[model samples]
Target chain A: MTIKELANQLNMSTTTVSRVLTGQEKKYRISEKTAQRVKDLAKAHQFAPNQIARNLRLQKTNTIGLIIPDISNPFFANLARTIEVALRKRDKMVLLCDTKDETTIEEESITLLLGRKVDGLLVAPVGEKWAHLEKTNNIPMVLIDRYFEHKEIPYITTDNYAGSYDATSFLISQGHHRIACIQGLVHTSANKNRIKGFQKALADHKVDTAQTFILGNDYSVENGYESAKSLLQAAEVPTAIFALNNQIAIGVMKAINEAGLHIPENISLLSFDEQPYFELLSPPLSSIKQPMEEIGIAAVETLFELLENKKVTSSRLKPTLIPRASVKSIVKS
Target chain B: MTIKELANQLNMSTTTVSRVLTGQEKKYRISEKTAQRVKDLAKAHQFAPNQIARNLRLQKTNTIGLIIPDISNPFFANLARTIEVALRKRDKMVLLCDTKDETTIEEESITLLLGRKVDGLLVAPVGEKWAHLEKTNNIPMVLIDRYFEHKEIPYITTDNYAGSYDATSFLISQGHHRIACIQGLVHTSANKNRIKGFQKALADHKVDTAQTFILGNDYSVENGYESAKSLLQAAEVPTAIFALNNQIAIGVMKAINEAGLHIPENISLLSFDEQPYFELLSPPLSSIKQPMEEIGIAAVETLFELLENKKVTSSRLKPTLIPRASVKSIVKS
Candidate 1:
């Protein structure tokens, strides 16, 4: 039933009925008894306002567009779930656009979301470019997980540098003079910061630069597999391997298994981002767990702040190093 | 720039310019030269049609509402990714509402989507009741993965009964007579049909019903863990455990690990719905792999057919049983 018909049947003005139904009774100074009476009748008639028509009149869709690199990736999937729940609590629905980690798709998704007139956007961009995103006409956007260095857009992300540095230090302390790092998407700030952290940790420990190696250009299992396979077959393999993400770590494990190598004994391994299955894996994988829930909550909070015209600043939360049985100690006392 | 502004600058009618811009040049019999001229100027000026205004005018939003029980679950996450890609190719964006496996949220999401006037809906219903969905006023919708048996809504899902039956038969063949089936959401058709298959397989094999058991009422790791823990501490533990879904299987594994029991040696384990990490598990779990990609593609096709007023029927695709190290050959001469 339409709200107008319900208002007529209740013997009340349409504005008074709308104010009561929309929870604006206090703002409009409507009497509590009158508001309750209108609500009771509206409920009895099962009346619902036409949100699309109302949204058009108000020029606000009350929807947020979420653009992520890969929805199938457990890290992003978990993050997306958290973000969705967080936004849903505030009565905002999400339009999910998975970019498949491609720059062109990311650009297209941004245009599509903007064209839908979403109240805000939360993006985990694929590439280093943000030119297409820059012309959003101030639609209250917030970058999540991935962002550009010089971009003015606010973002919430994990402290990748600290996470990586600690991970490298953990491996180094195990007496691993030679370590190989598998990186993802070379130009991304997350990847760059992780690489910096890995290198700095090695440098701080006075490890030889020539002994460490960095490889791969994409955040994928295949990239990790190929890099690990090549390294395993080399004349001298690194004593340990550090994967920048969980997908890469899975690939590294597959390669290790195929080569008849076991974790810790044959080669120690470490990965960024803890997965639910990590603990269930053989010997359990040692990982730097990203604070996905925190990131999700903070991103929504930042976006809502922007929607409210409040000044929002980018923030990064620390990641924790979860040491499992995957890493081996090579020191001989 | 607006279409009118672009039309005036090109010295052409707004309708002609719009027809070309919206990829309707062939339908409107607009010349190729005129289409090229219109596109060239539109691209140079970076002009985009306001989709919201245009959608309102046509009463078609080109958006589909997708309501799934869980997005963090790999099965649903992978399915969502595939559906999004398939629909995006048809120029449709998905408005995702993750129900978190709640019936109330499912109802609320349906109302929200209908309020926005989405072109179609694809839902993985959380519960058996579909009374709220019955009054959609002729909006196109296709249930995916989960649905009610008595509901008129069309759906595309995996053959759950066949998958469960085959898994049970495989276990029986391996000399596992005492088996326990851990179920998920007792009221769901998917779980009910799977239970039927498990019982039928045991009956065919002449395994005593009292020896075999069905436990758990939710699709969660905690349920699996609790059920397995109780069974493990019981007077007679089952020779093997059948987990209804991947989440339950993970929980079962956790309980087994905590009890210091090994897979296939102390007790065998089998799970419905294959996961990427299943093969990477300690003993590499044996599982029935659902055709998630096929189901996603079919659901979209069915929704689009409904959108075009074409006759559609609910169809079930077959699942494959993958045997790995978790299930051992206990057959004795």
Candidate 2:
């Protein structure tokens, strides 16, 4: 039943009936007896106490929009799961939109989220342009996983640069002079930082780079396979390969198997992002574990602060190196 | 700006302003001149047309709730992804609630979804009780993947029984008389049907069942690993195993690795649910591929039907077998 009918029958104003029915009586200084009377009438009438009606007065939908690149990826999926868990505790629900890593879809998601009147937004954006997001004026928002360069928008991401540098240095220390890196989308901030770290490591070691040193335009399993295939087909194949993410790493592994080569024997390998089946893979994989749960928590907390009109700073968590058996020492190489 | 304020400034009713702004002028029988006038004023005033307030009068939120057991599972993630894509096309957004496979959380999610005035609901239920769901009387809802026995609610799911039976029969055909099954939660309708299908296959083949024929009370990777370990340590270990899902199968794979046994060499395995990394695994796992995308589309269509007050019957789609190298033929044995 509509709140208007209930208000008329109860001989009360619409706001009083709405406030009491929504359990916001105390905030509005509603009398206990009046609240109990309203509750009794609401119960008798089987009234749903329309949340939409309450949202009208408060200008708060108590919902947030979450836009991410791909939910099929384990890391992103786990992050969404964790974020949902965290948000639910605070009486906030998320409307998820997957961009499929497309810029056009990402922009559309922003427009749709605004149209839906979500209280805030949590996004792992696919586009390099930050100006498009500024259109969400006065709507609280926080970025996650990936963001644009020079963007002042608050975001939480893994310290990809440090992790990449350490991983590259680890490979160099293993006596591998020629190490190939399978990277993500060329323009992504995460990839840019990773490239910087990789180059810094090589520069520190005085190792000259080849044209084929960095192989990637995307971060799909297919990209990993193709890049690894090309690397292996080279005149002087690298002794080790570093993948930017788990999806790519899995493809690289399959390519190695298809080529009649074994991991850490003919060539060593490493990857970013912790995969669920890592330990189960034949040789096990040495990888960088992005702190997704932590990132999820941070994103929620930051969004909450924004909702409260509090300023939030961007956050970055360190990725831990989970060394297994994929990368090996090349003492003689 | 509020629709009410914009309506007052334009000397138009709130309904007229809302219809024109939301592009429902034709549907609402508003005059073309009046509609154009409302749009011009809305644009001039920067009136975003708050949907929440309009929802009170229209009795439609343009939002749907999605309740799922877990989002981390690849199947469920893909389903959510597909559903989100489908819903966006119809100008609807989904409020995702992951119940963590708990009955209490599922109930809470339902209550919250109702409180949020969701236009409809799509659920992959966790509990056997139907009483909790009956509370959503006027709100349209459709179940996916799981359902109650006596509930009149429409559902869309994979043909679990037929697929399970076929998977089990394939294992039996490979000359593996001793076969084990790694099932999901025992009480779920999907699991119950799968168990029945597995038993039926064994019975049809005249293969004697052992006390350890079925080993599972959950579908987590940890459960799969533990169950496989126990099965492998048994006095009469099975030559083949049928894992209920990919998560369980991955765990089983890990357990086999820990025991220093190779897939298809010591034991063969066939899993339910198609995994993205199936081909990348050492043995290239064979699997029963549930028609997830089809089911997702069907669920959305069914939900839309319910929203339109149209009757929809339950549907179950067949699963296709994707054979790789994980299952071995023991012709000599």
Candidate 3:
């Protein structure tokens, strides 16, 4: 039923009914008992608020577009789920689009979301390009996971540099000198920061860069397999391998087993973003976990602030390590 | 730019430009050369075809709501990504809403999607309730994975009955007399068919129900762990356990490892729906792999057919067995 109809039937003003329906009764000073009665009657009649008309009136779409690179990867999937859930609580729905890690697809999705006139956008972009995204029609937008700090877009992401550095140092402390590193696109800030973290960890320990191998073509399983295959064929293989993400890490494990090596025994392994299945892996896995829940909450908060014309800055949260049995110690026993 | 402006700039009819932009030129006998020219110009200008305006004119949203039960589960994630990719190819966008396996959430999402004037819906509903879904404002809808035949809704799901039957029979042939069957919502069609298959396989082999244990409260990791824990605590634990899904299977693995039991030796395990990480597990799980790709494609196909007012029937595709090393042969070994 329409709010006006409900208001007339309840012998109450339309403003009072609207306030109660939108859960703004506290501001309107409506009694809790009256609010409860209104809600019970509305539920009985299966009343669903017309968000579309209301959106048009407020010059808002009441819809947010969530663009991710890939949903097959649990990291993106989990993040998307969390964001959608959080948005729902704010009485907003999500339009989901995946770029499949292609910059062109991401651009097209942005255009589509804009044409649909979304009130806001939350994106984990595929690349560093931002000149094109500058025209957001003043709609509130927040970046997630990946971002371009050179641009004014507000973002919430895990500290990739710190996460990768800590993961590398942990392996080195376990007496692993020669380690293999997997990388995504070399130009993206996340990749640059991750590589920096890996290299900085080795530099801090006074290790030579020539001792490590930076491998991979993308953040995918196929890249991991190919990289590990040729690396294992080398006469001097590394003692530990640090994968950038869960998808690639799974691929690395397969390649290791195919080469007849045991985890943390012949070859120690590590990855970022802990997944549920990671724990059930052969030796479990030592990996860095991103603060996804906090990031999801922060992204929404930034978008709401932007909606109010408030300035928002890019923010990064710390990543924690959940060490399992994937790393082995070889400290001169 | 607007279609009219683009048409005027190209010295072509607005209808022709619309047809070319919407990939419908060939239907109107428009020349391929002209269509190509139009497409190239559209790409050059980064034209988005104004889906919102078109939706308003046609009294259609030109958007489909995809309501999935869960996305953390790879099965649904893959299916969703595939569906989204396929839908985008047709110039349609997706509104994603996850019920998180909650009936109330599913109902709320459905109502919200309807109120948003969505032209169609693709839902993998939770629970067996259908009366609430019949009032979708006459919007064309298709079911995915989950189905309700009594509601006259079109659906695409894997052949759970045959898949479960084959798995149970294979375990029986391996000399497994005692098997544990984990189910998700026993009253649901999928669980009912799966349980039916298991019972039929046992009856055919003359194995008594007394030799089996039917457990599990839901299709979750926690349920699987608890069910497996209590089952392992029994004086006579089953020789094999057939988990309902991938998440449950992972939990079963954890419970087995916690109880100091080795896979395929102390207890054989099988599950439905193969995930990428399943192979990386300690023993590499054996699973009944559903035709997720085919189901996703079929789901889109059915939705399009419904959009065209074509009568579509619920269809089922076969599941394949990926026999990894998780199942053991106990026959006279």
Candidate 4:
């Protein structure tokens, strides 16, 4: 039943009924008897204001839009889950849009979310372009994981440069000068920063530049496999390999298996992202573990600050190096 | 810009401007010149109908609410991804609600979705009771993965009984007389059906019921680990073990590792869900692979059918048994 029907049945104006139902009886100076009659009738008819209509009147849906590149990736999935939990605490719901790592779809998702009149947005953008994201119709948005260079959007992500540099330094400390880094999505800021850090670390350690190499163009197991296959066929293979992400690490492992090799025995391996099952593998993988939960929580906090019209800037959480069985030390003790 | 402001600038009535913008100019007999002028001005001002208002007028949001108990679970994550991709093809958007496997959260999520006036709902329900689900406010809803018995709600799920039976029978055929099953969530239909299948398989083979055991209360790695640890401590140990899900399988592997045992060498393992990394494990795991993608697509299809006022029934797809090195053949070849 609608408010109109309830009001008519109660012999009261729609305005009076709405005021009473919305808890404005005192403000409207409605008589106790009249308010009681309206309430009793509404209860009998099981009438409640249509949420959509109510939202329209208040101009607030209390919903936040969340856009991510891929949901199957455990890193992003965990991030999404954490963000949802945090938002639920704030009494907000997430309207999720998975772009499948396509820029066109990202643009479409932005439009769809904006059309829904979401209170704010949390996006992990795809592609190099930020034009679509720029036109958020003044709706506050916080980018997570990936961001554009010089964009005004506030993002919370891992310190990719520091993570890569530390991971590479550790490999160098193990007396492995020749290390191959398999990277993902060359255009992404995360990849760029990681590659930069890897190169800088090698330079700082006085490693022969000619012996090191960077390969692969996307974050996928297929890319890792193909790259590792080619690298293994080379006469002078790298002593160690650094995979940019967990998916790439899996591919590298598959290629290593196919080539009749064992991790840390044939060559050392260091991955960027840490997965829960990493320890379950034959040789537990050493990894640069990003503060994923922290990033998610901070992103939500930043978005809420923006929602409150507060000045917010980007944040980069540090990544920790977890040494396991995958990376072997070759230095003589 | 508001339509009223745009109309004032063009010295035209809101109705005329709205008609031209909404492509009803010809029907309203607005002159071609006036329509072109209005369009030009609106384009200059970047004006478009507020989507929220437009949706309200049309009484359609073209949005579907997806409520899953857990997003961190790869099984559900994959399901949600496939469903989202399928819905995107139909030009529909998904609003995801993660219930965290709590019934109260599930109820709140349902109320939240209903408030948004979603066109339909797809849920992997938490808890056994369906009293809240019985009332969808006339919105089309389809259950996925889990369902309630004797409920009119349509659902798409794996044939838990057949999958469990096949897995258990495989162990029996391997000449393993004693086997332990680590189950998840006793009340869920999937868990109940799987338990029933395990018992039926043992009965058909005439294995001593006293030798087999069923343990675990949740589909978590902790449950799998604790159960395996206690079972290993027992004087009589099962020759083989079956894990109810991927998460549980990971835990079992951990327990076996802690016990200083090796897969197949000490005890054989067969798991329920298939994961990409399963093949990469030391002794690749054997598993019952459900048609997860098919289940997701079928759920969306069922929901759309319901939206079209078609009769729908529950569907159970068969699961495939993927044999790998984890399950040892105790019988002489």
Candidate 5:
């Protein structure tokens, strides 16, 4: 039954009936017995207290908004899962807004989130454009996995530059000079930092930058496979390859196998991020494993810090290197 | 500023002020000049119409609910992503309730969904006991992946029995007399059908049912690894193994590798569900692959069907087997 019908049945005004049902009549001098009766009838009828009505009375929605680039990606999916778990622990629900990497969709999602009146926001902004987001609302926001163009906002991300440099240097130390690199989207901060790291490794080893080879493309297994195929087909293929991500590495391995080449024998391989089945493959793959769980936990911690104290906070966690059999030393010709 | 302040500033009634702000008064005798003034004042003050208030007036939340066993699993994660994408296309939103494989949580999540007045529900029940869900609400619901104890409701799933039978028979044709099966949780209809199919294959081949072995566990990579470890340590290991899912198959391979046994030489392996990275491994994995995208699209279609007609419908899609390098013919001693 609707609130008006319930109010007529209880011989009370509609406003009084709504206030009682939403548990806001404690200060209204409504008798305890009357309030309890209204509650019992509402429960028996399976009546849902209108959230909008409750919000009108309380001036708060008690909901948080989350906007992420992609949910199909395992890393983002896991991050979303952890954030949901953490928020639930605090008795807050989340409204998830997936942008799918489209700027127009991202802006629309932000507007919708604002319209919903979420108490705060947890965003992983797409691309380098932050002006639209910065001007949207004064809602409390904590960015994760990527930084904002404006440094005023708090964000948490892994050290991509150092991680890439260390991964490349490890391969060089294994006596590999002719190395090929598979990179992600060029303009993204994460991809740019990774390229910088790869270059720094070559410079530190006194290897000519011109001798180092790089291929930039989208972050997909198919792209990785295509790039690796061309690299392997080169007149003088590199002795080792550094694939920027797990999916790319997997693709590269597929292309290599299709061409009758083997890992660490015909060509060595290294990648960022580790998958569950990485060790099961022939010649276990070595990788720069990002601290996923740690990052998830840390993002929540930063969000909570912002929630508790109305201040900005930022953090960047270091990545760890995992050595396996994917890389082999280059033998002199 | 409140609507009352805007009305006072414009020297109009609060109802007129709200009508202009909502664009409803033009047809109700309000002048365009007055409406523009109201709109300008509202915009200058960054005034947001209370959605909670509007929802209270309309008595609808405009949200859908999704209940899944585990969001962390890749299969379920992909399903959630598909549902989210579909909902976004229609300008509808979703509230995800992750059950984490607990029946109590499943029941609680349903209650929470009902409390929120979700327009419809998409659920993948955790176990055999789903009476609580059946009793919770009469809302439109479309079951996915798993079926209920009673078959009155609608669902969408892959043909597990047919896929399993074909995979097992293929192994038998390869001259394997002793075949071991690793099964998922027994409570699920998918697991039960898979086991039935595996046994049927052996019976059709005139093999002694008592000679074939079965190991039941959850469909997890770690469990697959542990089961494989135990099977390998046995006095006489099976010449062929069929893992019910990809995660278990991956674990089985790791266990075999750790035991210093070679695939196709020591033991041949086959599994259900294909992962993209599976072919990139040392020896490409052979699997019965489900049409994931089809299942996702079908789930949405089924949900809409239930929403429109309130009629129960169940659809099953067939699976295809992909032959790779993991399986080998058995040689008799």
Candidate 6:
């Protein structure tokens, strides 16, 4: 029912009814009994004030916008879950915009979220450079899982380089001299750090870095499969392979299986991130596990901090190495 | 900047500015050049007209709400990706709400989506009963990948019973005397249908119904692993195990590996739904492949139809089995 009808039913002026519905009548010293009566009647009638009227009166949507590259990825999905739980604790809600890892879509999502007048934003940018995001900097934002070129923005992410270096060095300690690396998208800082970590491991061992192998592609199981096939077919296959992410690692395992090779027997496999199915794999996978929960918690915490203190903060949490059967000790020449 | 300020700057009336901004001036015989000038000025000023205003004016959000149990599941993720792509092609956007398998959270998401006045909803309900969802008959909804008690609501789902029956029969065709089944959440129609199909297969083959095995749990890889372990340790282990979903099958495979048993050697396995990593397994997993893309496309299509026709329609698609190395013939028995 319309506000006028409710007002007429309550024998109150339309102005008073509007004020009561908008919760402003109390501020104007309307009697508590009258206000309660209006609220009870409105509830009984299942009256919902038009959103436009409510929004216009409150000047706030009470919603936060979340833009992520891919919601289907376990990492991002976990992050989103954590963020949602955290926000729920604070009585706030999220408006999610999945960009599907496309730059144009990312831009469009940002604009749309801004147009919605969300109180704040949490974004995991798809690319390093986002001019649209930079141009529309009016809203508060916290970048999660990935960073942007604009260092002024607050961001929370794992130490990709350290994680990769530790993983690579662990493989080396296991006597895996010849190693292959499957990289994520080359345009991002995360992929670059991983490459640096892999190279550093080879340099520390005084191994001819040229002999060490690297393949760059998007983070997907299909890409992992293709890269693993090419690496295994090389003239001299590496003793161990490091897949940058779990999806790729799964793909690599498939390639190895297709080639009639077994993990750590014919070759070793290691990857970044832990998949729930890892322990279920024939030979449990060895990898560096990023602190997904911590990353999400920290990102939300940072977002709130920025919202409250209006300050920019950046953090990179350390990654932990999870050793499993996938890595095998190589025979030294 | 407000419309008043824009009008002052452009030497026009506030009504004209509002009209041009809302795209109503043209219908009122306002010149095209003036409207263009107003738009260009607004663009230059970077004025974002409040979304609520535009939404109220247009009576549409151009946004569809998508609620799923979990985004990390490859099946749901793939489905979400398809929906996103399909919606994008139609120049529409999706607002994703991940319930993380919590029924309360799912209900809360629906309320929030409704509060936002989304044009329509595409939901994969957590389980069989959703009284809260039923209470809201105002919103047009299309259930995707899940079913509900409310028959009136439109839904798009796979033929779970037929798929399961075909998978179980295939194992019987391989001369499997004893077959086991790993089921999903029993509260879901999908899981119930699969179980019915399994039972039907055993009855058709004249196998002792009491000897037929069934394990029920969430459709996750961990459940698969645990169920496989228990099934293997049983007094009479089945020659073949039919996992109701891919995650469980993956877990079962891992359990087999850990037990130092080879697939199709000590035991054969077949599962419902195809996972990308299935082919990567040592012995490629045999699976019933759901028409995932079709389900996704159909979900959006159904949502649009509901919005346009204001009528509900339920549709179901069939799944096909993809034969792989996981299943082997029982030669002696």
Global CA lDDT computed for model 2: 0.87
For each candidate, give its TM-score against the true structure.
0.93, 0.92, 0.88, 0.95, 0.89, 0.91
Report the number of clashing residue pairs per model.
0, 0, 0, 0, 1, 1
Q: All models: lDDT? A: 0.92, 0.87, 0.87, 0.90, 0.80, 0.82
Q: TM-score for model 2?
A: 0.92
The clash number for model 3 is 0
lDDT of 1 by residue, A1-333 (tens): 777787788888889998998899999999989999998997786677776667767889899999998999989999999999999999999999999989899999999888888999999988567899898878999998878887788999999999999999999999998999999999888999999999999999999979889999899999999999999998889999999999999999999998998998989999999987788898799999999999999999999999999998999889999999999999989
Ranking by DockQ: 1, 4, 2, 3, 5, 6
- Which wins on DockQ, candidate 3 or candidate 6? 3
Q: Estimate the TM-score for candidate 1.
A: 0.93
Q: Report the C-alpha displacement of residue A15, candidate 3, in angstroms.
A: 13
> Residue B251 in model 1: shift from native, Å?
0.9
Binned by DockQ into CAPRI classes (incorrect, acceptable, medium, high), candidate 2 is medium
Put down candidate 3 lDDT per residue, B1-333, tens digits, no spaces: 778888888889999999998889878989988898888888888777655566646667778899998887788999999999999999888999988888889888998898887879999888567766788877888888878756687889999999999999999999999999987766567787888899999999999889898988678899889899999999999999999888889899989999999998999999988887788888999999999999999999999998998888789999988888899999995
Give candidate 2 misplaced runs (Cα > 4 Å).
Answer: A2-47, B2-47, B331-333
On the 0 to 100 scale, the lDDT of residue A332 in model 2 is: 77
Candidate 2 residue pairs in backbone clash: none
Clashing pairs in 6: A254-B280
Model 2, range A1-333, lDDT digits (tens) per residue?
Answer: 778898999899988997897679999999999999899988897777567767776777888899988887888999999999999999888898888888888888887778768899999887566666888966988889887767678899999899898898888888877999999887788888888989999999887776329888787999999999988999998999999998899889988989999988998999999887887676888898999999999999999998888877887799988888888897774
lDDT of 2 by residue, B205-281 (tens): 88888633888888799999999999999998888989998999999999998899999999999999997778767
Q: How far does residue B145 in candidate 2 sit from its true spot (Å)?
A: 1.3
Model 4 clash count equals: 0
What are the runs in model 4 whose C-alpha is more than 4 Å off? A26-48, B24-34
Error of 3 at A142 (Å): 1.2
Native-interface RMSD of candidate 6: 2.6
